[model samples]
Target: MNSRNDRTDLVDTWNGKVEEWPKVRFGDVCEIVARQVDPKLDQYAKLPHISGVNIESGTGRLLFLNTAAEDKVTSNKYLFYSGDVLYSKLRPYLRKALAVDFQGVCSADMYPLRVDRDYLDPEFTAWLLISDSFTKYADGESRRARMPKLNREQLFNWTAQIPPLSKQKTINSYIKWQFDKYIRSRMAAKAQLEAAETLPAAYLRSIFQGPEAESWLILPLGEAGEISSGITLGRRVSDRETRPVPYLRVANVKDGHLDLSDVNEIDATEAEIEKLRLKSGDLLLTEGGDADKLGRGTFWEGQIPDCIHQNHIFRIRFDPSRFCHRFVAAQIASPYGKAYFLAHAKQTTGIATINQKVLSAFPLMVPPVREQKRIALMLDARRTEAERVHSALADRLKAIERLPASILSRAFIGAR
Candidate 1:
C-alpha cells in the first residue's frame, strides 16, 4: 500500500503530541464523496429511510424501519454503502456522527464519505475525525449559530496528519480492539443503569400521579422550603491562594447530584463558613439553565464542612417539620414536576432560566407525611445501588480511556 513515513506520536485529547506527526490537508488523505439516489420527500411514504451519527464516538446507523415520525427524510438522499463514513454537519463539537457498513438512504444532515484506504484506512479515518485535528477543523468551519454547523467546502478543507495505509490499518485494528471492549462494557452497564433508574422513577411517578391512595397537596416551593440562590464567585487571581472558603460553581452540581471534585479555594474567615457551609439535608437546585435543567435538584451529603455555591445554583432547605430532602429530589426528578418548573422559566439567550422570585413560586407536590418517609427510604436504597453501578462503570470507562494514550505513547516514545 502507498503510505507516508512521517508517522509517530498520537496522544490523548489533553496530552501534548511528541514526535510530530506529518500534517496534510484532510482532502489529501480522503475524499468527501457520496451519491444521491432517493425518492423526494413525498411525505406519503409510510416508512422513509434515516440515519444519524453522534460524532463523539463515531456511532452511526440507518433507519431500516421507521422508529420515529420526525425522521425528515427529504429529497436530498445519499446512497450509503458498507465502509462508507457518515458525518453530521451540525454541532461538530458534540462529534455527533458515526461510521457504518450498510446500504440505505439517510437524512440530508448526514454526509456519506468515501475514505481512500491507500492513504486513509476507514477505521483510522473515523479515529481521525475524533482526534484533535478534527476538533480544530470543526471549530474553524462551524457556523455561528445556536447549533453550529459546517459546510461541505469547509469539511473538504479540513486537514490532518495522514499516516500510511499499513500504519493506519495497524492503528485502526488496535484502537478497534480496545474500543470494542469499552463499547460492550459501556452498553451493558448503561442498560443495567437505565433499568435500575426506571424502578425508582416509576415508584416516584406513581406517588406523584396519585394511585398512592393518600392525600398529596400541591404547594409553592417557597412554602415548602427556604429558597436561596448562591453568590457569584468572582474569578480568582494569582495572589488569591491561601484561602479558607471552598467555592463551588455550576460544574459542581450535575445530573441532580453534587460533585465536589473541583473546589475553588477562597479567602474567607470562620464567619463565612456559617453562611456558605452546607448542611447534610440541603437540597441543591439549579437556579437558571436550559429548559431541561431548569429545576434539576440534588441532595448534598455534607461532605465538606464549609462550601458555597455559584449564582447559577440554588440551595433549597425544607422545613424538617414537613418535607424531606430525599423525597423532594425524587419529586423534582419526575416529568410532571419538572414540566411545572420549565413552564414558568423565562427563556433568554436560548436557555430557560428561573430567577429567585419565580423559583420561589414554583409549585411542588407534597404527599402525605408518612408516605414521604416511606418513598424516601425506598428511593435511598435504590439510589445506593445505582451509585454502585455508576462507580463501577465509571472506573471501567476511565481505565479504558487511558488505553489510547498508553498505546500512542508506546508507539511513539519507545514505551510498551
Candidate 2:
C-alpha cells in the first residue's frame, strides 16, 4: 500500500465524510520571505538572536534568548518580524518551530516564514509544523541527506489538510488549552521528584546527631579496624609473572551501593591479588575527587568473586565481633562523617583528598552489636521506601513529557 495515499485517505475519513477539507501545498499558504542581515551591524547588534537550540522541540516554547552582541555572532542571519514563524531546517525530526512575539535576527539554518493572512494563521502554522503528519513527511524527505536537513524544495512541496480560517483558529485554541494542562501536570511531578531526592540526606542526619549520639561509645577507626590501600595501576613488574584480574575503580563505588556494570581488568601477580582481594561485608571508600565526593563509599557484598580494587579506593575490614559493617557504612554516609572528613581532608585547588592518617583518625560512634543491627535495619527500610517513590516520580515525569506531541497530533492530524 502507498503510505502517501493512506495518509491522505485517513485525513479525509476524520468526519466520516470524503474530502471534508481541501489539501494544499505549504508554500501556497506561507512564503519564505528572506531579509538577511549582518549581525555585526550597529542596527542588529543588540537584537535577540535565535538559533535552532533556542526553540524547544515539539512545544513552540522559546528558551532563554541571547542578544547578537552577547553571543558575538559574526554571520549573516534571517531578519524576522514579531508575527513570523521561525522553522528550523536542520534535523526535521526534532520538530523545532515557534512563533515569536518580538523582532529578532535568527541563524540562517532556520527559515522565517510569513503566512498569508487570508489563507493561514501564524499560530496554526506553528502548531502544524510540529504535528505528527507533517513531522513524519519532513523526516522522510530529510533522511536521505548527509546531515538530515530539509531542503527548500522538499519543505515547500509538503501537503496538509486545511480547513477554513475560522476552523483553523478553533483548532489552535484547543491545542493551547491542552498545552496548559500538560504544563501544570509536569510542574507538579517535578516538584515531587525534587522532594523525594532530599530524603536520603535527612535520614542520615536524624541518626548521627543530637544527645543520643553522645551516649554511644566513640573509638578511632584505626584502633577498631584495619585500613589498606588497593593495587596501584601502571606499575612495572616485568620480572614477576602476572595474570589478569578484575578490579574496582573509584567510579564503581557509590554512596550506598556498588555499580558493578563496567568493571575493568588489570594485570597483577598472584601475591598482589591475594593481598587486595575483596571480602563480603568489607567497606570500600574512595580517596577523593570533588569536595562533595570526599570519603564516599558503601559496604561490599562480594558480588564479583576474587575482585580487587584500584589504589584510589581504600578497603576497611572491620572486626566482625564488635562492629556491624552496615551500621558503620551508614555512619560514614551521614552528615556527621562528612563534616569530619571535610575538616581533616587536605585541599589542593578545588579537589579534596584524605590521607591514611586522616582516615585512621575518624571518630566512629559505636553501639552494641544488637543495637547496631537494629539501626541499620531501620535506615535500610526508610531508604528503600524513598527510592521506590523516587522511581515512580521519575517515570511519571517521562510520561508527562510526551503530552505536547500527542496533543498536536489530535488537534491538527485528527489522530485519536
Candidate 3:
C-alpha cells in the first residue's frame, strides 16, 4: 500500500521510467465480452442489476445495488461475471465504470470488458478507463456521436501503454489505498457539517424550550400576526390586467435563509401584486416538499422590491410592536415547529403539505418583545459561526472529489 507521499515519489520515478513499458492499443489487451440477455427471463431476473447511474463518476465505485426483478428491468442487458470491468459507453465524460466481484446483469449501455489477465489486471483496466488520457479521448470521440456515445469501435481503437503485470497491480493498489483514505476524510467532514447545521436548532431549543418558556403566553400564530397565501400562477385571468413580475417560489425559501438568486417571474395583475406584495421583515414559509422541509422558511428582507411569492409559499406579517419577525421565524424553523408541521401535514404519495389553515393554527410562544429580540440576536450570531464552518468543510470535500483524477493522471499519464 502507498501513502500520499509514496504516490508522489512513485509518480516522479514513473515520469523517468514510463516509456519503457510496452505501448499497445486498448483492444490488444481487452475484448468486449458481450452476452446480451432478456432481463425479464427467470434466470437473469433474480441477478443484481448494474446501470450507468449506479456507478459513481470517476471513482469506479458502485453507489447502490438492486436486483433486475426489483427494478422490473424489461429490456435486454449484458451478463457480466466476477472480475470483469463494466464501462458505460453513453456519456463518456461521466467516467462511469467499475470492477465487480459478483455476477450481475448490466444495462445494454455498458460494456462487459474482459481483459487478457496476462497483460492487464481487471481492476487496473477499470482504473485505466478513467485516466485523464482515456477520458480526454473518450470525451472527444463521444461528442462526435449524435447523442454523445462512445461507439464500440471508437473505444477499442484508443491506444495506451500496457505496463507489466506487477506494475499494473501496483497502480490498482495505490489508487484503492488513496481512495479509502479520501472516503474516510469525506465522511468525517460530512458528519462535521451535519453537526454544524444542527447548531441553530440547538440554539432554538435552548431559548424556546427552557423552564421560563412555560411562564410565557402561548397563542396560535394567526393571533399574533397575519398569515395569507400568495397569488396563484398559471390561472385564467379573464379580462384582468396581467404583467410579468418577479415572484419567489418554494425553491427560493430555505431554512432560515432566502436564495434570491434566480428568482423567477410570474404573470399577475396590479391588485394581485398589491395584495401579495412581500415587505421587509415578512416571514415566508414553503407550503410543502420533502417531509423534513414541510415548514422550511426564512424572513424576507425586501431584497427585491415589488417582489411577490407564489401560492405554494405562505407569507406571515407580524405586528412589529407585538412580535419580532426574526424571533418568530427562528421559532418556526426549530425542532418544535418541525415536529408540529410533520404531525399535522397532509401526506399523500410521499409528499407532505401544510395549508393556510394548518399554518394559522401553529402554536407560538410569546415572550416580552425585548426578550425575543435578545434571543434572536444570540441565535443569529451562532448561525453565522456555523455557516463559516460549513462553508470551509464543503470546500474541502470538493477538493477531495478532484483527487482521483489527479492520482489517475499521474499513474497513467505521469501528469504532475
The lDDT leader among the candidates is 2
Model 1, poorest ten-residue lDDT window? 6-15
Q: Write the per-residue lDDT of candidate 3 for residues 20-81, one digit (tens) a residue.
A: 87778888888998999999989999999999989989888889999999999898999999
Give model 2's clash tally. Answer: 0
Worst 10 residues of 3 by lDDT: 407-416
lDDT of 1 by residue, 1-416 (tens): 21233222233321243234566676665666666664443433333355554234333222245512345544656666677777777767655545666555556787777877666666566666655457556866785655677877777786555555655665665555555665676677667656665665565566677665345687888888987766555544445334557766777887567778777776654545567677778888776677777777788887876777666888888776688788888788777667777788888886887788887786677877677888889877877877786677667666655554444333323110
Ranking by lDDT: 2, 3, 1
Query: Model 3 scores what on Cα lDDT?
Result: 0.87
Model 2, residue 203: distance off in Å is 0.9
At residue 324, give the lDDT of candidate 2.
94
RMSD for each of the candidates = 12.2, 5.4, 3.5
- Residue 346, model 1: Cα distance from true site in angstroms: 1.0
The residue pairs found clashing in candidate 3 are: none
In candidate 2, position 39 carries an lDDT of 95
Candidate 1: pairs in clash = 26-159, 53-96, 53-97, 54-96, 54-97, 55-95, 55-96, 55-97, 56-95, 58-98
Q: What's the lDDT for residue 289 in model 3?
A: 88
The candidates, ranked best first by TM-score, are 2, 3, 1
